[model samples]
Every structure is written in C-alpha cells, then in structure tokens.
Target chain A: MRGPYTLVHAEDNWQTDMGAWFSGERVVFRGKDLFTELNDFSWFKLLMFGITGKEFDDNQIKLFEAIWVLSTSYPEPRIWNNRVASLTGTARSTCVLATSAATAISEANIYGSQAELDAMYFLIQAKQAIDEGIELKSFVINHLKTFRRIGGFGRPIINHDERIAPLLNKAEELGLANGQYLKLALDVEKILLKERFRQILNVAGLAAALMADQKITLNEYHHYSVLAFSIGNISCYIDSSAQKEGRFFPLGCERLDYIGQEKRDW
Target chain B: MTKEKECITTNIWHEEAEADNPFAAKAAYCSGYDVYGELLGKVSWAEYIYLLFKLEKPQPWQSSLLESVAVAIANPGPRDLSVRAAMNGGVGGSTAASCLMAALAPGAGKNGGAREVYQVMRLWQQCGFELSQWQQHLANYQDEQAVEVWPASEHPPGFDPYGASCTTPVLQTLDHLTSLCPEEGALAYLSEHRQQLEKAADCPLAMTGVIAAAFTDLQMTEDQAEILFLLLRLPGAAAHALEQKKLGWRNYPFFGDGLTLTNDPGPAPKEDNLQGAL
Candidate 1:
C-alpha cells in the first residue's frame, strides 16, 4: 500500500521538538518525560519553556505565573467570549464546543489578547524612539497623531486599571521589576497622564513589559499572552455550565425591535 | 535527481516602480478603469465597491442589493457583541480604533457576523440551490446522529435564535430588496421553503441567511459575500462605538450580586470535626 499522498515539497517540511505521543508508552515533551519530569513543573513554567525554549528560575516563574493568575477568570459573562460560553452552556453544549467557540470569539481585535501583542509592538517601537533621544512626550504626541490611539495605554471602561499596582508590586517582591521595558512603560504612562490623556498601564501593558524584559521573540510574545488568557475562557465555560437551561439572558420576541416594512404578501 | 523548487510569482506588483504609480497624478485606474476620468462622480460607492471586487461594474439590481444590504445591517444597536465591546472600550477610555477592533473581533465567530453567513452560503451551495435536497441532506445527517452537522437546538447559522416566529428587520428589508432583483431564484426558493427550512432548523431565517441567499443569487463567491456583509456591518459598529463614547463611561458589571454564587463550599466546612470539638 502507498503512503499518504504528499502535498508539500519534502524539503519544506516544518520541524518541531515540542511533544509527541508514543502510542501505549510514555510521551516525550521538550526532551523530558511528560509523566515524570515535565509533569512536576508548574503549568506556567511549562508554558514558558514551550514558547521560549528556555527554563526559568523560581522567581521568574513566580512573577510570570502571578501575572497569568491575576489576569485570568473575569467575573463578567457579558464579555463577547464569556457570553458565547454562557449561551453554549444554556444550550447544554459540550465543554469542548463551548470552550472552542468562546476562545475563538476572544480573538476579536478590539479587546482580545491580540491587542496586547499590538500594544507590545508599539511599546517596542516607542522605546527605540526614546533610545534615539526622542522626548517621550514628543514621541507619544507623534504616535497619537499618526495612529490616533496608543495601545496598552488607555482602556475603555476605567480611568485606571486596578491590576497594574498589584502586578507591579508582585514584580517588585520577586526583585524582577525595574527592567528597561518596565521603566519605559512607566515613562509612557507618566507622559500620557501629564498630557491629561488619563491613560494608565493596564495588565496587558505590564504583561508586555515583563515579556519584553525576558527578551521573548515577537512570535513567542503573542503565543504566551494568548495562553495566559485561556484560563478565563475555560472558566467561562465552567461557570455557564452550572446555570439553568435557556437562562442566559433569554430574549423574548418583544425584545426584537421591528422597524422594517409591515406584513406583505409573498 | 531532485527537481528544482518552483518559485512563487506575482503580477500584483512590478519591479519597475515608475511603471506603476497607483496614486500618481492623473493616472489612476481602479480594476483597470480610469478612476478619475470615468468613475469619479459617475459611479456610486456601492457600484465602485462592486467594480473593485468583481473587476467589473455591477448591474442596477446588483448595486441596489449591495446598497440595501449595506444600509440594512449597518446597526442593530449596542446589544450585539461587537457594539458592546466597542462601548466597553469607549468606557475604558480606549481610542476609537481600539474600540472598533474589539467590535470586529467577535464578528469572526459562527454565531455572529459575516463568517456565519458564509457558512450558511456554503451549505446552501452544496445543496445546489434546491430546498428539498438541502432538507434531505440535513435529515440524513440527523439520522446518523451527527448533531454537529446542524445542531437544531442553537440558532443554526443564518437563522434568528429567538424562535422562528419573530422576524428580523434586516431580513424583512432583504426580502423587499431581493424581490426587486431580476435574479431572484435563490430568494424565491428560500421563500418557497421557508416553513420547511425553519421546521428543519427549528428557527426562523435571519438577515444573515437573507444576505447569504441574495449574494448567492448575485453569483458571488463565499469570500466576496462575507466581505460584503463585513462592509455592511462596519458602519453600524462605528456608530455603536461613537454612541458609547457620547454616553460617557459606564460600568459593565458581569452580573448582579443576587446572581452570584460560590462554586465550592470548602469541603463542607471540614466535615464539622473541629466544630464538634469546639
């Protein structure tokens, strides 16, 4: 019998050392035994290892894991992803479907984790400009003029993100704070605040700064940030599953406003 | 001997920069037509959009359908995910673009926006524009217990979730708009099998379905149809974001205190052994 038909050129095969199942035997993950060595590591450590291909010390793990723990598990189900999960739960959908659907929705450009990646990219550029002796205020002003919005700065609902101080404090406690990216993030915030922009470094901004400090590549930065938020999507599904059927904001016929042409014969 | 690798090529751009200046003075062509001389003020925005996508100008009916769809699905208020996200972004003091981006994110889902419509169009096309064939296919899937193929419980993409009795304004508008078009086979077929389709899916046809059928009738590809839907929804998203900004920042509490509950009760207070000793 012939092997599976090949579509791509053999030389162009993508390579990976991530992980692979071995039928009934043990699994290999990042050159370690999945059931023994890798299983002993914290999920955050494992995630970081997967993305950066490097191991971290205890303090680094603590700080990184704290950021994920703090950001995960949003209480509000009204958010797009959460709402989808809730709806799925109300309809008694499977956990896999619920989480998959919700996570996909969470990828929306506006408030999704991708925004964090964009904000981080902006910060990287802004920091480079600053390193070139461009005034922070001038740099910000120019950015605002060009893009009309600076990522990782202003949020939508609150004047300040309550998550910033605590994350910063955690970073400080771990003695991992005061890196170049963190300082730059603070400087940007100060300039924006001085300009009465009312923008503060949100959790996304801080996460970007920390990830940058680790010298994570652009691709890893995006992947890690998304992985950090997966918990929230899962929690949404779990929470929604506990709810009664047809109870997730069940909209009646009256709720639908009809302003189109009145009844007409086909 | 191994063959040499084939290099990907493109006609989209030329090496000589001087040969191609899209925005150059008095020398601009959109889809190979004189934009300044022939298209300006002569073609409506809808017709221009059609020209850009199809590389040809649309018929009166096509342009009319495009314009109608664009106008109809523009805004369904702040209740929509994208609009709500935009509003939330506004309240958080996010820039207009960031808010708009949030609105666009959830639109990629099967539940809402153009993607869902595209899925419906694909299914409809697979059925060869025949209602009976589609029904039979759905029934066969049902017989095999393939709930994933067409889950009747949830709003089957392109159908309103809030029961089949209620009619969406956009769907109604689509009905009138598509009726005017010369190529009304898709719309007519949908109308003929409305009851059967609704019964099979357990929901009424939505604006997404109507738009999908209309696009099919216009002989648009799935991608083109989806893009048209996105274009139609963009203005509505912008409006919602603007309105939220105007309304000022408002707190979006996930749920009231009354609805809050603990998932675990701490192992039933350690089995009351310490309490009994106390």
Candidate 2:
C-alpha cells in the first residue's frame, strides 16, 4: 500500500513564482508580504495583483473599481447566469455551490468568459492588423469573412447596448476613455453603425478594448473576469432566498412549447 | 429594441402547473413520462439520468453499464489534476461552486480529462475494433482550427502522456467494465485489443479509454459522452474540495518543498501610476 505515489512522483522538484505560506508567521501573496508590504492595498487592488502579480496606483484602482461597480455587477435575476444563483438560493444551497454554478453558467456561447475571451483576442489581433497598415474598414470586412460571428461588437437582444454609455462615462471620468484600444473599438462601432451591421459595442467590447489598452493577456483577462457578474448573481441569490421556496421563476406546462413525442404506456 | 425569442421551448421536459397557480408545478414530465408519478420510485438514478439525457428509457444492461462507469470514475482522488483543482478551491476557502468550477476547467482538458473521453468516444465511433483504422486515424490527426465553443482534444486522445505504464486502477476498471459489457461489444473489443490500441496510441491506455469504451457500449454520442463524463466525475472533486476546505491550507499538501517565490519581486509601483501600463 506504500509504493511511491505514481501521480506526483516526478513533480518533486517543482517551483513557482507564485508565493507560498509560512504557517502562523505570514502569507506571501505574489511575492509581497500580505500584512506588512501589501497592507495598504485594497481588495480590488489585491484582485488585480493576484491576476498579474503587479500593483496598481490608487487612481487606476479607482478606475478599475468604477469598472467593477458599473460594468457587470448586474443585480438582475433574469440574466441567465444570475438565474442559476437565484435557483440555488431558492433551493437553500451553499454560497460556494450557488456562485460556482452561476459562474459556470457564465461560460455560455454568446455571453460569459468564452465570448469575453473571444472579444479580447479579436480586439488585440485587430489592433495588430491595424498597426500592420490594414485599413479598419477593410480589416473589419475581411475579419467578418473568416467567421459568421464576431464577439465584442454586438448585443444579442437589443441592437443598442445600454451598458456601453455608462462604462464610457466612467472611463471618461477616470480619464482613461481615449486609450488607443478604446478609440479603435469606438471607431469600429462607427464603421458598423454606418454600414448597418445592426450591432453595437456591448459592455464586453468596451471592457475588452480597455483591457487591451492595458496590454493584459488573454489568460489574465479571463482569470480577472471570472467574477464579472458575481455581484448580480449574489444579489439574485439573496433576493430569491429571502422570499419563498421553489419560487424564483416557476413556469406552467401550458407555457412550455413541448414539440416532442407523446406519452406511451411501457 | 424588441426581444428576439418568444417563450421557452423544449423537447425533453415539461412541468404541469398546479390547478390554482400557473407558477407552481404539481407534476413534471420528462420525455413524456410522468416523472413524479410514474418514474420516481420505479427506476434507478442511473436509468432516470439516461432517460433525461437520451430522451428514452434505457435497457437494463445499458443503465448498469452507465452506472458502473459513473461509479468507477466518480472520484480519481485529490491527486488527479481535476480533483486537485477543486481541492485548491476548497483549501483556499473558495465557494463550493468555485471548487466545482475548478473541477470543470481542468477536468474538461484533453490531458486525462472529459474532453479526452469525448475525443476517445469519437474515435470509437470512427475506428471501432479495427486497429489499422486507429493507427491511421491517430497517425494522420490534424488541427484545422475549427474553433469549437467547448473543448476538443488538445493532444492524442486515448492514452496517458505522463505515465510510465498502464496504471493498476485503469486496468482494473477496464476489467470490471469488460465484465459488464457484452462479450463481443465495445468494451470487449477494447479489452481484447487494448495492447494493439496502446501500441497505436504509443502510450498505455488511461481510464478515459475505458470510460469512453463503456459509453460506446451504451451507444452514447460523442457530445453526450463528453458532458456526462464531466457530470459523473464531479462527486470526487466536490468531496475532496470540501474535505480540504475543512483541513485548512496548512493541512493541505502545498507540495513537498512547497511553492517558493523563485523570481525576485520587481520594483514597487509609483503612487500615481499603474504598474502594468505598457
């Protein structure tokens, strides 16, 4: 029963730039001492730190805080991922389970991490193309030819995205609205608007452009955005739990369009 | 702007509203079976899940096969990459859902992950028991960059890349599942041709091969096999995560020497400037 463990047998010499603990002494976070060296950092600052292993100034942190507060902290229960949290709350589930499930639901095809990542990659690559002397209009049309769907440019339900204006306002207030990637995004929006593509810059596109301006890698953006809508999710959860059992969004059989087989006696 | 869709539509599920309230469901029907009235006590959880996913009741052997594979791979231990990811969440005081998310992210990988099971399931459909087909298929695999929404194979699908030999648990699982499989069916074909299959893959058969073979015996499609593989393996991940959560990070194995900050911390950021600005 005591043969050498096959799973981690050869991982004996592993090293990480990510920090480790010192038991009761202190915790090291991204090479900074949690209590001493990084004692002044806010939770938002620490969140960015955890993602990039770098620190941010107070103003920049305030800008990120504005993004965090205004961008996707949606408290709406009807939102797909938030509904999962609401359902979990209605069922009297644990916080971790509820948030995790909701976060998992956030990986939907059109929305969530996958779409966000796609948008960021597209923005980064498009900027590279623009830098390489490709005209914006020509590049936009050519990029459209490669795939039927391009993320970060459109809202699924409404042609106009309501979040874009608020985010832009915040970015303007923070004095970061005119960054190169943000300008590119707005320029692309103009092209699409003039050409009648029926899609506008959604929150993801704006956020992606802002992130790209900061040169955040796709992986870092993904990890950083994991909890994008947690505020809304937890709010939905709280509201649902405070109400009644199994009562988030109940639907009648008559409401359902069951277009399949009929009942049969087995 | 007008909303795109109308009311929700479904082929697999319908719930009858109570006589008094349209919002309250009195009974549920799954694929036209009275789930609460007719099927709840009559069928096993395994059969119930099969009916829910496949939209039909399973034969006894099919349900049994599904249950066996599900139980076998239920938890691959905290040492498994997926399970460890979950444990990482649990030990760090992350939410339970986050632990499962941790499980799914790495668990969905092609390296001994559910995606590998999906890839292997597709290969079973393409190759069956034919070793020559497997050899050709594995040899000629290419990346077309098709851009799937969910994960596909990241590498060759069937075998373990890191192992020195076929692990004992994998062989044992294959044996147990082989007993449940039809004598001449998918599991049998796999069990008989495992050596040749290993040779073709150029690595020992991992548990994903066995699980995928068992799913093949149940006639699960590649996509179904992929998702079910994710669902079935969550139990172990959740259990380990919760256990580690209670054990605290100190009790958790942070590695033998533990993680060290090998790189020196860079200069601290200035007061009015972001550190990562280009």
Candidate that would win on lDDT: 2
Question: Top model by TM-score, which number?
Answer: 2
- What CAPRI-style quality would you assign to candidate 1? incorrect
Candidate 1 off by > 4 Å: A1-8, A11-15, A32-39, A258-266, B1-278
Candidate 1: count the clashes. 12
Model 1 residue B238 distance off true place after TM-score fit, in angstroms: 35
Q: What is the interface RMSD of each candidate, in Å?
A: 25.8, 5.0
Tell me the deviation in Å of residue A62 in model 1. Answer: 2.0
Instruction: Name every residue pair that clashes in candidate 2.
Output: A74-A232, A96-B95, A96-B96, A96-B97, A97-B97, A100-B97
User: RMSD, model 1, all Cα superposed?
Assistant: 22.6
Deviation (Å) of B103 in candidate 2? 5.6
